[model samples]
Target: MNILLSGWQALVDYLTIARVISLIIAFFLSGAISTFMSKGAVMKYFGPNAKKYISYAIASVSGAILAVCSCSVLPMFASIRKKGAGIGPAVTFLFAGPAINVLAIIFTFKLIGTEIGFARVTSAIVLSIIIGLVMSILYQKGEEIDPNENMFNIQEENERTWWQNLIFFIILLAILISGVKHPILTIVFFVTLVVVLFLYFKKQELLNWCSETWILAKKIVPLFIVGVFIAGVLTAIIPETFMVKFVGNNTIGSNLIAGVFGAFMYFATLTEVPIVNSFMELGMNKGPVLALLLAGPSLSLPNMIVISKVMGIKKTLTYICLVVLLSGVVGLIMGNLVFY
Candidate 1:
């Protein structure tokens, strides 16, 4: 009975108007990326042959503006991958979107210690790049993009002007970033975006954007909701005492436990900081704390389910393993060496 209630409550909490609005904005932004952004542009920026340093750098830093949660990032991730982005850069963007969220990092610096906060930021960026490179290397054969491919033939005409598209995306990003936090400002930005759309974009383009967004929403949202409910049920049943007992020491085993636990748990946006602080007060080690921070925001149950649908089960599992392993190893290093 309690578990069922917990699941229902999770649904209730997640379906708040603010979150719903933010998610809708994300879907639209994702649609714009898929429909309006030319495939040539995507390939030039994130294709396999693009400059490695530049691609990874863009993928990592771009997350700063998104400030989204694990599940919220899926539509964008799916869009980029669907548009023929290389596995490496797409994966980097996926990890970075939630992990390196600017607002969440700021919250970490304020609520958590400066040292751990700094470690979290640096580690997430480094880990994202490393994981992306490794995945690209491992999956090279399957992901190879032929230059002559029809997908790459799609191009944007120079006459359309880049700045006009830039302003359009900027407004969409503003609405997403503002969310429901500044309802009036969000409304203003949304109205502006609508006006820009009607004036600057063709009717067919607008319809295509809506179609792409609806397709992504249909594919991801149902699984996202189910994963949230299951996570809530698991939250109700899991013993906090057990978590605390296993992660008190900074041993590799403890870090691994923390990493695995964090990977499967849901932490909405900036919530991980206060939750980790509470666990620290209850005797959690700094290493495991870092491990949790690294894994928590980037890989939730809801996140995993949606990612599996976007990529295949094999790739999804590999990605999960990589994140959990890297998080544990990094946490162990921080605890045993840096913090010590």
Candidate 2:
């Protein structure tokens, strides 16, 4: 009984810390992306008729910094697409946005080993470019739009200087680094940053920003809590030995299966880390570990429902399948080379 209680307590502590860190990272990075990187700039560089491969590279790299979850990325993706980004590049952004984000990568490294971490990053970048190229080929000659129509006209804010923005960015970075080392300190550091930023900015402006951030947090936090609870329950109920039966060794079949499962299973934003850690403790192999890391966050249940509404069922399903298959193949190949 004592041991069980201790385990439950540990789970709660970990979840609380992880959630705080994820929120801090998400809030600051999302704000920075909105402030510094204009949609117009993205369109100018990767607009229609841009070299297909170069556009793909740019889209992947840009998405890495935003580090938003799958759901949060949808609106931005839609806005960019509506504005006239080529189908290929737009899709690349969609894929890379969640897959290669800084927070996701950091969480991956922390939860899993560094080997899987690098694999996840490399696979995401390669898969993003491949997905873009294939999407481009499929949509080529289907539709085209004028670049000017697609340009984003973001209102510039003169209230905050570039130096102030830089300070916010630095504070965010420090919070992330500190959170990785000391979980509870993360909460303190993040709160400090938020308070400092608020004091520094005008009251009305700060209130507006806080309102927006809170709205996003409210939307996501409940879902996040539910996900953590589910994971904890699964950890408690499922026997590690049973899970080990399926993924004890880094077998090709196990890796592929894990990848496919990850692609299909709905992992809420930032939820994959805890769930993956649970699986690892259950004796899942490194190969399957990599597979899950690569595929989980990119596709989730809520995310699919939202995407289906936007792109319609057919295209959404097609996109989901392609991501799964590609992720599985990539994991299979990597597992064979690295683990075998």
Candidate 3:
């Protein structure tokens, strides 16, 4: 009964109106962006033959537009990888597609300290690129491919006018950026987006966006709720002393533990932020918190399975190892240098 109540309470607390609205809008915004970007655009920017800096840049920031969790992003990642993206950029996208999502970043900044939030995001982006580069360099013989063959001929290329695109993106951005601040402002942006969708966008486009949004919501929201409930239950069961004794210090072992644990546990969207926050309150050190944040969303057991199927076991194992190692190093450095 106590565990049931704990889980129920967590579900109730997290399933608020504001959170629901934010989730819906964020998923819709991501859907719209992905539709606009298309397979061809992803190939152009993230293909193997693309300039290294440009590809990595795109990969490192792809999550801002994707808004998927580690496991959820695997299909998209595999699609691009099979479509001809270099192992490096594709791996970067795999990490960034979940790590740098807007909801996660905002929630971290809001629920945690400002500096820690910034560090989490920065370290995630840098480490994602590093992992990608290392994987491409190490697995070049098999992973290297021609970008031209990967490029698809998009029939809807440049279909929307520049102004239409600008307005669409601006409205989505406004809604997302303001969702964290004022409720009224977010509503206003949402209303404006709806109006633009009806007036400017084709009926088919609107329907497609809605379908994609629903797909994303169905895939994410359920797991996210379960994860939240489990996190709450774990917090209740685990003694504070245990957390402090094991992860209270900013040591190499502690950071590695956090990273390894996070790599194995699945986190959906912003779920990791709150779970890690609970761990922090239980006496987990700031550095280990960052380590968890860095690895948690980008790598999980389910995520690993999907990636292995796509990239082969050897490549997937190498990527996971790299992510864990780099995450630990970043957390250790941050712990010692920044906050201590």
RMSD of each: 7.0, 4.6, 2.9
Off by over 4 Å in 2: 1-10, 13-40, 43-46, 49-54, 101-103, 144-155, 158-167, 179-209, 301-318, 336-340
Residue pairs in candidate 3 whose N, alpha carbon or C atoms collide under 3 angstroms: none
By the lDDT metric, which is better: model 1 or model 3? 3
Question: Which candidate tops TM-score?
Answer: 3
What total of clashing residue pairs does each candidate reach? 0, 1, 0
Which is the winner by lDDT between candidate 1 and candidate 2? Answer: 1
* Tens-digit lDDT track of model 3 for 52-162: 889898889888755556666788888777778788888989988788876678668766779898998888888888898898889877755765743644445566777
Q: Between 1 and 3, whose TM-score is larger?
A: 3
TM-score order, best first, reads: 3, 2, 1
Whose TM-score is higher: candidate 2's or candidate 3's? 3
Off by over 4 Å in 1: 1-44, 144-244
User: Of models 1 and 2, which has the larger TM-score?
Assistant: 2
- lDDT of each residue in 106-221, candidate 2, tens digit only: 66776666777888888888888788778767665666586674364444445566677677777777786676668688778778787767756676765665665666556666
TM-score of 1: 0.62
Model 1 poorest 10 in a row by lDDT? 145-154
- Report the error of model 3 at residue 49, Å: 2.8
Model 3: residue 64 alpha-carbon error in angstroms: 2.6
Q: What is the TM-score of each candidate against the true structure?
A: 0.62, 0.76, 0.85
